[model samples]
Target: MFRSIVKQKIPFLDLKIQHQQIKNEIFQAFEKVYENTSFSGGAFVEEFEKDFAEFCRTDYAIGVNNGTSALHLAMIALGIGEGDEVIIPANTFIATAWGVSYTGAKPVFVDCTADTWQIDPSKVEEKITPATKAIIGVHLYGQPFDVEGVSSICKRHKLFLLEDAAQAQGAKYENIPVGGFGEMGCFSFYPGKNLGACGEAGGITTNNKDYYNELQRLRNHGCKERYYHDILGYNMRMGGLEAASLGVKIKYLQGWNQRRKEIAKKYHNGINNPAIKMQSQPDWADSVYHLFVIVTKNRENLMEYLNKQNIFPGLHYPVPCHLQKAYTHLGYKKGDCLNAEYLSNHCLSLPMYSELTDENVEYIIEVLNAYDDE
Candidate 1:
């Protein structure tokens, strides 16, 4: 008689497990928001903004509806507009480019570092031009980029520096948090992020009071007082419910990030396949491992094999921004950003979350090792 083997199914991200862990806290926060009818920006949002600002070690934080809105407002507040060019790494999510586009600015693409998957600071200077106005350094996969190099370049060139810190919440470089390193640091609190809210939410951290006040106005229809407008702005204010939930989650971010680090360490030490290339972590970076990605020439085959075993994974980005159809008018071709293009094809995100179990990690490692043998 032949016996049937049942493979254990592992999800790429298990938000349900995380929710279960904080169910009561999330419920109570929602209850408070409902009771007070503070649906729009209110005390809940204000409290979270202050708490998050302290967490990022910044003097102020302004909450917005989403990360894209945060980036857009930051660009607008910094005076990035038509005829301006902003340099961004090509390997990041398309929203980074969208932010620049929303401000009527051109997004100049730069290739990421092959090992770190971050914006190559060495390649940045060559891209700077007379029209260049700002540089948005993205902390991809929760790892902080080379802040000192980028900061120095920004200082020398007299360009504004922004941190697209969507994936990096608790990450640090040189023992300092990433969000406070630049003029403005943007964050996303999507349900899956390191410091997630119940729904969509984002915020910006800054030490400059002027920028902080300007962002607050930009997010609230350009109104410092009721029925008064200084500049045309979007209604991009964050909701009270999302802020309340985020306030609860913020208290647990460090612990959750630590758990993610432990999981990443296990993957790094156990997955000994020569064909698989792991991301290099610099000594100065303390990454939170948002999505533990591995690069392999046989990515498609490996992904298929893992799926058959009921172990689902994900792709951070399968297509670089330059090659996306939406950006075709930018006149970029396939090889314009070679490193980012290569990473888009080779990268594969493993199942990584704070709730991922030890048994699952072992099973994944075993399956990967078996695939290497095959």
Candidate 2:
């Protein structure tokens, strides 16, 4: 039992430690922005977008103000609207469903696979209706959803496929990256993401030329010309400063993802306890392990024990999107998405940043095993 001598102690996510490592380079990035005072979308943002597109193996990339904005713009470009419906997994951040709502489309909630915590592609076809215009497949918790299966369904049904790659930036399915798998991929650059910005930022990736251009227009003030207006577009431009910060982080995403994979592998192999089970990986997914969540029978007690030891953990979602107050209009009751609702209660994310030390991991496991013995 460790007690803090100085009172204040260890952190769940130490951005100070992370920022210290890249201080010089990050400072220079900020200096360039200050020198130019180019805050809005410009050369800096464009360069980052191009670099990110190549990273995702997509033909084009559009930088936006935030991940939610990216999702909304992607939906708009697909011409999704009031009469149309978008199918989304119930086990995701509210932003996923909200994006569909932003386009004046109804989001149809679908269940997730018990094993992978991702949208169950096998169940997708059953939900398809004449009003189904698109499918927003989410790669939840850094593991890529079954893209091949969902893609086949969409192709057979002639529906658009959008990849919500917010948490799966470096994750892959069978050697292909997640972003390039669907028609368009939306990413978030919130401060805690795998490749985060200093503040809010996001990007979209696509291979289709027409969709890409229309998305570009949608991200701007919906104008193809500098001064002309067109569709009802949201001002979702990614700032130059955020782009610059993200650029520095993007260069290290591969390395950081590799580290996260190593930690996840350790967690999978360690913590020998039957009362708790780590999130399982799909056979085809080359997951980046964005969050090493575990399902536990004694979730509340385990969380309390970890907290007592200063081992801060996170609950990815205590409430599923469909059950949230904002989405009560979806008309889904408690038992509707049982798997998702159950997972929300049992699923808990361990401290999983790239900077987490092996000693700390071992300590966490040791504490977990000790608690399990009780």
Candidate 3:
């Protein structure tokens, strides 16, 4: 048996180790930006944009202040405004809905699939109305939603398709990168994301030249030129320091993602507890395993047990967006998005990071298996 009293604490995530591995490269990136004095948005940001665009296999990429800004700008660029409606997964982080709400559009929430914990494409159409102008398919927890299923509906209904890839930097759907699959893909490079920057940062990817140009203007005060303003816009440009740091980090993203997958595999195969349920990976999804979420009716008990053993897990979201107080005005009741509400109450994320050792993974699995669900 493992030690009854453990001294090692397994955190839900540890960015410090990740930072340590790439410290020299990140510092060099910072030094270059500092020397250039392009503090706001300049060459460093531009270089990262180009590299990121290439990585996602998109023709163009636009860096923004943060992921929320990226989503808001993408919606605005799509002409979503007051009286318009957007379809999004109720299971997602509130930011996904915020993007639509910020654009003065109503966010219609859809339930998630029971197994994959993704937006259930089958349930999306029922929520669509004449006001529906777009659908934001979130690649929640780094697993791409059913792109083909959702895109088919979008095409049939003449609605814009946006990819919310905040947790899916290196993820793919059907062997193709995510961002390019939709009209526009929004990514967050927050300090905790798979390809996180040193600070808040985000990027948009698209193959549509027109949307790309409009997004560029929208993020930079609606100006193509320094002093000329083309349209009313917000000051949401990404910082040079964040961009430089992101550029350096992006180089290691694929490797880090691979390691995350390896750890997830260990958890998947080792956790034999019948009371615990894991998210299912469809054959079409090449997830980066941003968060290895598991569901259990006895979540609070399990959490307390893990805490005693110095193993701490986290909740992706303890509340579903449709049922949140902020969206109460939307008039959605508890059972409106059934699967999402169910998962919200039951799901807890395990410790998932590239920095975790094989022994760390085995220990986590063992602890989980030993948990008393009753």
Q: Candidate 1's residue-wise lDDT over 81-191, tens digit each?
A: 999999999999999999999988999999999899999999999999999999999999999999998999999999999999999998999999989888899999988
TM-scores, all candidates, are 0.97, 0.96, 0.98
Candidate 3 local lDDT, 1-374, one digit each (tens): 67443468999999999899889998998999999998999999999999999999999999999999999999999999999999999999999999999988999999999999999999989988999999999999999999999999999999999999999998999999999988899999999999999999999999999999999889888999987998997999999999999989888889999999999889989999998999998899999989999999978888898898889998999999999999989999988988998898888999999999888788888888888776
lDDT of 3 at 350: 94
lDDT, residue 282, candidate 1: 93
> Which runs in model 1 stand beyond 4 Å of their true positions?
1-6
Q: Candidate 2: misplaced stretches above 4 Å?
A: 1-10
Ranking, lDDT, top scorer first: 3, 1, 2
Using lDDT, give the best candidate's number.
Answer: 3
Clashing pairs for predicted structure model 1, backbone only: none
Displacement of the residue 110 alpha carbon in candidate 3, Å: 0.8
Q: What's the lDDT for residue 203 in model 2?
A: 91
How well is each residue in 250-337 modelled by candidate 2, as lDDT tens digits?
A: 9999999998898888888877888887777778988887788889876888888778877888888999988999887768899888
